[model samples]
Target chain A: MSEAVQLRRRLLLLTPLGVAAAGGVAFLAMLRGMQSGNFDPRGVPSPLVGRRIPDFSLPAQPPDGVGFGSADLLAAGRPVLVNFFASWCVPCVLEAPVLMQLKEAGVPIWGVAYKDQPDAAAQFLRANGDPYARLARDEPGRVAIDFGVYGVPESYFVDRSGIVRWRWAGGLSADTVSQELQPLLRKYA
Target chain B: MRTLLLLLLLAGPAWAVSSPSEMLPDRAQEQRAERIGEQLRCLVCQNQSIEDSEADLARDLRGIVRSRVVAGDSDRQVIAWMQARYGDFVRLDPPFRPLTWLLWSSPVLALAVGAGAVLAGRRRHAAPAPLSDAERARLADLL
Candidate 1:
């Protein structure tokens, strides 16, 4: 065969091979994405970020009689951290100490007792060491629904303007508090 | 057999009561809510649509859809509101956008490449050129 014909045949043979290589690359990229947590099953990205906190007014969990409301968030002149917790949730227990530490550091952390009975929620606070500056009862979880809370032990950091700056789902460990919450708090505060 | 029949009849009402009924003010609005709900994915369940999912979030989403439909929001407006609150992941069928271009186009690209390869192979292996008249005559003599 002439050199041109030979080259043409070779190029034709390479076409499918090139496509196969491309397929392999795409497959590898998908695997890498899964490994790097692009679609993390544990958490969904909060759409509340950069938006005003959802409106809610919930009765306070005693011994403090003051209720928690969206107005409180708006009236606050400083940044605030809002935590959603439930007495029935185990992760809430795990994150209680970290919340205490945050309070000790003078972070104005508000608490929402989501879907918990008053007695159970109060007992949980007493047992875990009360860290909330203001605690509210979200008995029907209407407020939690507005906040897009999937489960308990979620936290939101709001800036002075009442916009949610950050949110962390699941439990907060010491490492997460330091690496995630602390930095965001520093920026906003 | 009569006792068993009686028990089944007794249990049937409980089953009917447990199943979700139309919570919207009217049937037409309830249907609109269902159509919208079917398009929205249940964030908690991931795979099931809010209409099909019994998860708490799905129920809440269904309620939101019904309320929006009742409040005179268009279907598109309701969906946009949901997308704003839950991100694009809440939709069962994502809109065609730059980020989803690969997801929407990769299958077409693969099919095109596959068809091209098949056609090229067929052309390369086309039936041997029909025997020339001279060659046929020579083969006849040899036979």
Candidate 2:
């Protein structure tokens, strides 16, 4: 081959390989982040953080549970956890004990039964352990949508002024409660 | 190649998720809602648009979009409303912003890298040896 042609051919061959190497490095870094729990593929950051709770008022959960709204959260006088959960959500069941622990520690917890049938929700609470001080039913899910809830078992920590300080999208565990929620609650408190 | 084709087609079973009961009465508005919904990611379903996911959240999102349409929101306003609530993650088409500028600029970066690589490779092989006198004679004959 001609000298110039050989030079051009080498350039063509090496350029794609360099690009492939760059792509591979990026992919490996992502895998490391995922493995180290530094990145959660499923966790979506909430925009409502640091903003006031959206306008919403839900009716009481069925079978005599008390109802609450944005104003109620403002009047809480301390940080409160507003949890969107449902009877059908298995993660909510897993999250229940940690929620109860928080409630026992004098943290006021509000519940929104997201898209759950009234009777089913009431029964689920009774069976899974009700830790909520006041409960509401998001029957049509409008309130939950306004609060930017995507799935059941999501929780938002609202400051006394009703600002959403933190939001967790998945089921809360003891570790999450102790590590993330407690510190955030303390900060706003 | 099959995976690439699947990604091009959104890699999912595209089903009719928005039912007639949930549609707007005005056909044009409903169509607008549908178009908007197709551009929105369903929060409950990974990588599926609200228009393609059977999840309840997607249905709610569809209704929300229609409500905004009914209230006379422009397409940008409707999308902004969603972004206000759900962050830029709600959009199937990601917004170009500071946090996501890297993602948007990645293609440019890749092209730059490739160009750089080609230039470097070209330089490393620069000044190739002069053709043999015999080869030059052969080249002259061919020309």
In order of the candidates, what TM-score does chain B achieve?
0.71, 0.75
Cα lDDT computed for each candidate against the true fold: 0.83, 0.87
- Which candidate comes out best when scored by lDDT? 2
What would the per-residue lDDT of candidate 1 be over residues A6-85, giving only the tens digit for each residue?
99989889988998999999889878866644546545788898899987789978766887888898898899989999
lDDT of 2 by residue, B1-143 (tens): 99999798974554365456786789899889889988988988869989888898887788789898999999999999999889888888998889999999999999998999899879878887789999999999999
lDDT tens string, model 1, B1-143?
Answer: 99999998877343211145536658798787888888998878788888887776677778878888999999999999888777787788899999899999999999998999899889977876678898899999999
The DockQ-derived docking category for candidate 2 is medium
TM-score of 2: 0.80
Error in Å for residue A168 of model 1: 1.1
Q: What is the interface RMSD of candidate 1, in Å?
A: 1.8
The DockQ values of the predictions, listed in order, are: 0.47, 0.58
C-alpha lDDT of candidate 1 relative to the true structure: 0.83
The local lDDT score (0 to 100) that residue A77 gets in candidate 2 is 90
Question: Compared with the true structure, what per-residue lDDT tens digits does model 2 show for residues A145-176?
Answer: 88888888899998888888989887888878
